[model samples]
Target chain A: MALPGFLRRERIVARPGFNRWLIPPAALAVHLCIGQAYATSVYKAALVEDFGTSQTAIGIVFSIAIVMLGLSAALFGTWVDRNGPRAAMFTSACFWVSGFLVGGLGIETGQLWLLYLGYGVLGGIGLGIGYISPVSTLIKWFPDRPGLATGMAIMGFGGGALIASPLSRQLMSYYDPAYDGTAGTVPNGDAVAALFFTLGAVYLVFMMFGAFIVRVPAEGWRPDGFDPSTVKQKALVTTESVSAKNAVKTPQFWLLWTVLFCNVTAGIGILEQASPMIQDFFRTGDSSTVAATAAAGFVGVLSLFNMAGRFAWSTTSDFIGRKPIYMVYLGGGLVLYVLLATVGSSATWLFVLLAAVIISFYGGGFATIPAYLRDLFGTYQVGAIHGRLLTAWSAAGVAGPLIVNSVLDTQGEPGSLVAANYRPALFIMVGLLAVGFVANLLVRPVASKWHEPHSDAATTPTPARSAAR
Target chain B: MSTSVSKDPTPNGQQPVHTPAALIAFAWTLVGVPLAYGLYQTIKTASTLFTG
Candidate 1:
C-alpha cells in the first residue's frame, strides 16, 4: 500500500533543527531544470530548418507544453498534496527527462508529432508537477517568511532560461562546429538530436537532486522563534484553510486568478515582442536605432529582471502583505505600459527601464502567487490551489500573445512597424492592468463556508525530532 | 523507541535532526554551479549588446 522506503513519505520530512534553509535549493533544482521551457527559441530556428516547417509550426511545441503544464498541474495537484514532495518530484523528473529523450528520438527519426508527444505532452506534465512540488512544503516550513521562501524557489524558474539558452546553443555548436546558429545556416539535425539526448541526461541528474533532497516539515514544527498567534493578526491573511476543489468555488480564489492572469498577460505583451518591439520603437529610415544584437541583450537584461523580480518582489511581499504587493504590480505596470507607448521613443533608456520593471512585476506575479494562496487558503492544500491557479497562466500564455500579436499583425510588418503601431496593444494592456488592480482590491478573506474545519495542517501529524533546541 | 532517545538532544521538546551539512552543500553545489554558469553565459551574451 505504501511506496518503497526509499520513496516513503516519512523519510523526507524535515525534523526540528534540520536546517530549514536546505529546502529552497531542493525546490530550485527542479525549477531550474524545467525552466528551460523558456529557452525553446534556441532550438526553434534549427527545428524549422530541420523539418522544413514554418516558424509557427515549431512554436506550437512550446505552446503545447505550456498548456499541458497548466493542465497537468490542475489535474495532478491534489495527488501532489496527498502523495508528498518526493513522489511528486520523482514523477516530475521521469516525465521531464523522458520528454527530452523521446523528442530526441523523434528528431533522430524525423517525426514532428513524436517531438510534440515527447516534449510537449510529456514534458509539460513534468513542468506542472515539478512546478508545484516544493511550494506547499516551503510554505509550511517557513510560515513566518512564506513569500521569501517560495520566491527563492520560483526565482529559479525564471533563471532556468538564462542557463538553458546559451547552454543549448553551445551544445548545438559542439555537435556541429560549422553550425554557427546564423541565418541561412542549418544545424545538423542529428547533432540537434544528440544535443537533446545530452540535455535530457543532464537535466535528469539535476532534477534528481530535487527529488532526493526535498522534505516536508514534521507536523507542528514551527520555526525556532515563530509565534503562531501573530500570523492571525494580519487582516487579509486567513487562518482558515480550504481544499483545492472547494477553493475554486470561492470568489477570492477566482479574483486572485484574474489578478495573476492579468499580470501575466501584461508582462507577456512586452516579453513576446521584446526584440521586435524595441527595434520598431526606435527605427529610423531602414536601420533600427536599436541593433539586433542590442535587442537580444535587451531580452537578456529583462531575463535578469524577471529572475530578480521573482526573488526580490516576492520577498518584499512577506512584509507588505500580498494584496498591496499586487497593487504595485498592477497599478505601476499600467503607468509603465502607458509610458512605453506614449513617450518611449524619446529615450531608449526610459523605454528599457520601464519595460524591465514591468517584466519584473510579471516575474513577481508568478513567484508571489503561492504565498498569496498560502495566505488565503493556509498550507493544507495550498500546493493544489497553486496548481489550479496556474491555469490562469496557461490562459494568459495564449491570450497575452493573441492580443499583442493580433493587434500588431493588423498594424504592419514586424521590423517595419512604427512606435505608433504598438499604441493599441499598450492601451489594451493598460486596461488589463486596471482590471487586475480592481481584482486585487476586491480579494477579501475566504468566506467561512468554504474553509476546512481546522485552520491549518491539523491533519498532518508531527513526528518526533531527534534533537530539538 | 528508547534506544536512541537517550542520545537525542532536547528530550523535553521535539528532537532535532539534520541532513549532514556536507551533503546539503554538495547537493546545492550540484545545482548552483550550473545556474552560475547559465548566468555567466547570459551576462556574456547581454554584454556584447552593451559593449559591441
Candidate 2:
C-alpha cells in the first residue's frame, strides 16, 4: 500500500545543516503520550465501581493493551520501516486518540467490551508503532552514540507515567471536586471518561507536533567529525546489515530475547505488586507499620529510578560495551534480587534501595537492547527487529505478574500475607535473572551467513571509503 | 562495484538550513517543562515514604 504524499519518507529527509538534536524531543513527545498506559491504576478503581466489575476485569484492559503493544509492533514494524516515522506517527496518533474517544463513549454508555476494543486493542497498536518509530531514526542520526540517542528517547517512555499519573489525578479532581485521588476517594465514572477525552485531546496535539517536526537524516549524512572506524572497533558492533527476516534465524536474537524477558520479569515482579508487596513485606501481625500513603510513595520512588536508569544505564553502554552492560543489568541484578528476597524486610530503607536498583536495571535493559540490536544486526530494519523483540516484553509482562501473583495466592490471601510468603516468588525471580545472565554471556556476533547479500553499510559510503574502493 | 549514492552532500542542492539556537532552546523547553513538573510532583509525593 502506498503512503500519502505528505507522509512519505522521501518528503521528510533532512537538508544539510539540519539539527539532529530536534529528533529526541520529537520522540519524547510521542513516548510521553503513550506512556499514559502505565497510569491506568489512577482510575482503575473507578472503572471497577462504574461497571460493578471485578478488579481483574479492570486489570485486563491494561493487560490487553500491553499484549497488543507487542503484537502490533511485531506486525506493523515492517510497515513503519517502509513508510517512515511521519506516517507511522500519524497513524499512531489517529488510533491512540480515537481509543480515548471510543473508551470514553464506552464508559458513558456502560459497555465494557467497547473499553477493551478501544483502549486495549486500538490504543495498544498506537503504543507499539509510536515506541519504535523514532528509534531507528535516532540510531541512524547518532551512529557514533546510538546508545545515548536511543536512551534519551526511551527514557521518555519511563518518564511518561511520571507526568500522566499526577496530571490524571489533577484532571480527575477538576472534573469531580469530591474526588481527591486519595485512598478512599474514587473519581466517578463520568469524571474518568472526561479525563480520558481531555488527555486524548492534549496527547493528539503533542504527538502531531512530533510527527510534523520529525525528519529522517538524509542518506550518507554523518556528523562532521565522527569516525566510523572508532565505532567499528567496538566488539560485536557489526558493520554488516542483516534483514529483519534473517535476524530471527540467529541465536543471538533469542539469547538477547531471553535476557530481556528475565530482566523484565524480575522487574515486573516488583512493579506489579509494588504497593501491596511493600506493605506485605513489612506486615507485623494483623497490622503493618507501613501506611497506604507510604506505599504509594514507594511506588513513586521506584518510578524515578526506572526513568533515571533508562537514560543513565543505556548511555553508560556507550562507554562500556553492550554485552558488559547486560552483565551488569542481569548479573548484578541477580545479587540484588537475592538481597531483596533474603534481607529486604529487615529495614524499610534497605528494602526500598534494593527494589529501586532492580527496577533501574529493568528500565536499563529496555533502553539498551535497541543499541545491542544495532551492534549485532546493523541498522537495516532495526526498528522492525525491535518490534519483534517486544514480544518478549509482552510474554514477560504476563509471566512476571503470574509468577508473583500465583505464588502469593498459594501462600495466602492478599491483605493478610507477610514477608515470608513473598520469599518464594522473589527467589523465583532470582533464578530467572541467573538464566538471563547466562544468556547475556552467550551472545555472539551474527554469523556471516545471516548478513544481507548487499550488506554494505546501511548508510552511504564515505568519500574516503569510496576512494579506497 | 561502487555502491549507488549521490556524491552531492545535499541531494536536492538546497541551501543549508541553519537552525537557530533559540528554536532549539524553545523545542527543548516545550518537552522539558512537563517532564520537570512530573519529576517535582513525584519527588514531593515520594518524600512521604521517608518522612512518614
Candidate 3:
C-alpha cells in the first residue's frame, strides 16, 4: 500500500529510456475501462424497465457481477501478489469508483439492495482487482513477449464492449429524451441514475490512468537480446516457481483448470445464445426470417471474432507453443462444434463461419491463460496463478449459460426453435470441445514436488541465480 | 536493483525504444476512438444486413 507521491514504486519503472511500448498503453488504460463488463447488455433493457424487474430479476445483476468476478479473483489474488500493480491499480480505482457511486445511489433511491450492494458486490471487487492488475506488470515487462505481452492487455477486454455499447447508447440518448435503446422505449429511471454517475466518473479517470501508468520490473530486467535459453527450448516451457498455494496443488494446476473449463464451456455455447441464436438459427415460419437488424448483424460479427481472437490467438501463442495453443483451442474446437451440429442449418454464411471460429477460440482462451501460467508456473505466481484461474471463468459463467439456456429451454422458445432444436445444444457444445481436447492432452511438467523452494533452478546455485538477478 | 531501476542502458544493455509522437497519439486515441465508434456502429447495422 505504498503508492502516493506521484504514484511511487520508483516513478513507475521503465525509466531507462522508457517505452516498453509504454506498457501496452498502460494496460489498455485499465482494460478499456474495466471492459464495461461486456457492455452489461447495454444496461439490461434499462434494468428491466427501470426496476419493474424480472428478466430473472434483471439476470441477477449480471449474475452477481459474474460471481463477484470469480470471488474477487480468488480472494484478492495474493493481495495482487503482495501489493504491487500500483496498489492493485489504486484498489481498483477505489472499488471501481465506489461501484458507480453506490450504484448511482442505488438508482436514485429505488434500491434493489443498493443495486446489489453497488454493482454486484462492490463492482465485483472492481472486477477482481482491475482484472489482475496489469497482469504481472505485463508478464514482467514482456519477458521477451509473454504471449505478446499478455495479448496486449487481454485485447482491452475485448475492446471494452466496443467502447461501452455505442457509448451506452449515446449516454442513454443524452439522459433520456423519452429513452431509445430499442424495445418499446420508456425506461429512464432518472436516466439510469445519470448513467451510473457518468460511468463512475469515467471509470475514475480511466482507472487512474492504469494506476499512474503501472510499473514493477527492475531486478535484472532482461530484454535486449533475450536468450532465456531460446524460451527454455519451447515445449512445456518452464523456469519453475509455483506458489499460488502450490498452484492449487498441481496436476499442472488442474490441467490448466480443465483447460479453462472446457474452453469457457464451449465458447459459452455461442456467447449465451448470440442474438437469439442468430434469430433462432434462421427462422422460417409464420413470420421471422432473421431481422432485428439481422440479429444486430450477428452480434456485430461476434464482436469482430471476439476482438479478433484476443489479439490474433494470443499473438499466436508467442510463436506456437503454449501447448500448441491448446492444440488449436481444443482440437480446433472439436471441428467447430461438429460444424455447428451438422452443417448449422446449411447457410447464413455457413452458420456465421462456424460461429466465428468458435468465438475466436473463446477469445483465445482468455488471452492464452496468462502465458499458459507463465509457461507452467514461473513468473512467480503469474498474477496469482491468473487469480486462481478465474475460478474457471466463474465455473464457465454458470456452466455455459446453463448448458445453452437449459438446452434451448427444453427444445422450444427462440421463435419456435428448429435446427433440430439446436441439435441437443449443439451436441452439448460438442461434449464441451471433447472435454477441452482431453484437458489439452493432459498438460505436464510442474512436478519436482511443486518447485519454489527458493526458485529451484535445479536446486539453486550461481550465487542463488546471481541473487535472483 | 540499481535504486529501483531506470536511468541507464545502451552500452549494449538495451532499453531505448522511445514511442513519443505524443505517446503515440495518446495510445492511439486510447484504444482507437472506441474502435472507431464501434466499427461505425457495426458497419451501420451491418450494411443493411449485408446489402439486401
Candidate 4:
C-alpha cells in the first residue's frame, strides 16, 4: 500500500503563498481525459462492424466501464484519501492508459473480452479514482467556494465527450483511408485500434500534468478574507467530520443517494434517447419532419447544455446553498418532465428547450453532489463518501435506460414510434423526480451519533507529517 | 457531538503569497485552449439543429 516517495501525499503539500488557482486546471487535466468515456458512441458503430457483433455486445464495454467506475471509486476511496490526490491521479493514469493500450491490443487480435478487461475494468478503476482524487483537496483549497472549485473540475467530465467525440471521428478518418467520417462509413478495426493508441498517448501527458501539478493545501490554510463561521451559519453546512464508514449509516446519505438517482435517471431518459426521441416526437407520419442531421445536431446541443450546466449551476450553488439547488434540480425537473411528456410534440423548439434544461439539471446534479456531501458531512473522509454515493449513478445508468427502453419497447418498435409512445416513460420520470424532491426535502445534517470525535481538532497536523502517515 | 467551524488566523499574517502571475496564466492556458476548441466545435455542430 506504500506509494513511492514522490507519489506520497506528504510530498505534494503546498508551501505558503502557493497559488490555489493552479489546482483547478490540474483537476481538469485528468477529468477531461477520462471524460472520454461518454464519447464511446462516436466509434460504437465502427466497433460493431469490425467485431461482427451486436450493438449490445459492444455497448457492454461502456457498461462494464461505468460499473467499474462506481465499484473502484467505492473500493479505492479510502485509499485515495489515505494517500492523496497525486498518488490517486498517478494510479488512475496508469490504469486508464493501460486500459486503452490493452483494449487496442484486443481490437487488433479480435478479442472482445480483452476490450472489456482493458477499458472496462482497468480504465474504470482509473475513472473512479481520477474522479474523486482532487475533490477533497479542492474543497480544502477553496473552502470558501467548494461548489465553484468542484464544478470547474467535474464539468470537464461532461465536456470531455465534446472534445473526444470530434477528436475520435477525425482520428478514425485519418487512420482509415476508406472511412470518410461520414454517415454509414465505419472505420476498420485497425484504425479504431490505432485511434485508441493515439488517445492513450495523448491522455498520458495531460493526466500526468495533473498529477504533478496538483497540491494539497498546507495545515491551517484558508483563503484570504474567508470566514469559516459565515459558512457555518447556513442551514445544513456542517463543520464536523464523519468517517466514510459511518456516512452510509446516516439517513442523509441515502436521501441524497435517492435524489441523485432520480435526477440522473430522469436526465438519462432524454439523453439516451436524445437523437431518436427528438425525431420521433416531431414525426408527422412514417417519414417525420426532423432530418437525421438535425437530430444529430440536437444531440450536440444537449451536450453543450450538459457541460454548461455543470459549471453554471454548481457555481450558483456556492451562493444559493446546496440543498436549495437540489430543490431546483429535482423539483423543477419534475415540472419540466411533465411538460416534455405533454406538449413536447407541439413544436421542435419547445421540445429542445425543455430537454436542454432537463439535461442541464442532470449535469448540475453531478457537479453539485460532492459540494452537497461537504455540506451534510464534514471534509474529513468526504472523497470516500462521494465515491460510495456514485454507486447510485451506476444504478441509475442501468435504470434510466431500462425504464425508457422497456416502455418504448412495449409502445412499438424504434424509428417508427410516435410521441405518444414516449409519454408513458416521461411520466415515469416525472414520478421519479417527485420522489427525489421528497428525498431532498428530508435531508438533515448528520446526527451527533455519527460524528468522529475531535474532528476539527485533527486539522492541526502539519500537511506533510499528517498526510505522510 | 456538536462540530463547530475553526476560526484560525491565516498562517501568514499581513501578506498573502500567490503563484506568479505568469505561471498562473500559463497553467490556465494549458487546459483552457482545448476546452475552448471543444466548445467551439460543439456549438458549430449544434447550430445545424436550427439551420438544417
Query: Could you give candidate 2's per-residue lDDT for residues A1-469 as a string of tens digits?
Result: 7878999999998766677888888899898889889889989999999999999999999999999999999998888888899999999999999889999989989999999999999999999999999999889878888889899999999889999999999999999999987789999999999998999999999999899989887666677567777777878999888888899889999999999999999999999999998999899888888998999999999999999999999999999989999999998999998998889999999999999999999999999999999999998899999999999999999999999988988998789998889999999999999999999999998999998776356445633211100
Q: Write the per-residue lDDT of candidate 2 for residues B1-52, one digit (tens) a residue.
A: 1122334544355555655667667777888998999999999889989886
Each candidate's lDDT (Cα)? 0.87, 0.89, 0.77, 0.89
lDDT of 2: 0.89
Per-residue CA lDDT of model 1 for A352-393, tens digit only, reads: 899999999999999999999999988889989999999999
Q: For candidate 3, list the clashing residue pairs, or say none.
A: none
- DockQ, cand. 3: 0.14
lDDT of 4 by residue, A1-469 (tens): 5679999988887756577788899999999999999999988998898899999999999989999999999999999999999999999999999999999999999999999999999999999999999998998888888999899999999988999999898899999989997787999999999999999999999999999999997766666666678987999999888999999999999999999999999999999999999999988778879988899999999999999999999999999999999999998999988998899899999999999999999999999999999998989899999999999999998999999999999998888899999999999999999999999999988899898888455756433111110
Model 1: CA > 4 A from native: A181-184, A455-469, B1-16
Best by DockQ: 1
Q: What's the lDDT for residue A156 in model 1?
A: 96
Q: How far off is model 1, as Cα RMSD?
A: 3.1
DockQ of each: 0.37, 0.36, 0.14, 0.30
The candidate maximizing TM-score is: 2
lDDT tens readout by residue for model 3, A169-210: 778778987766665675477777888889889878877876
* Fnat by candidate, in order: 0.54, 0.61, 0.33, 0.56
State the weakest 10-residue window (summed lDDT) of model 4 chain A.
Answer: A460-469
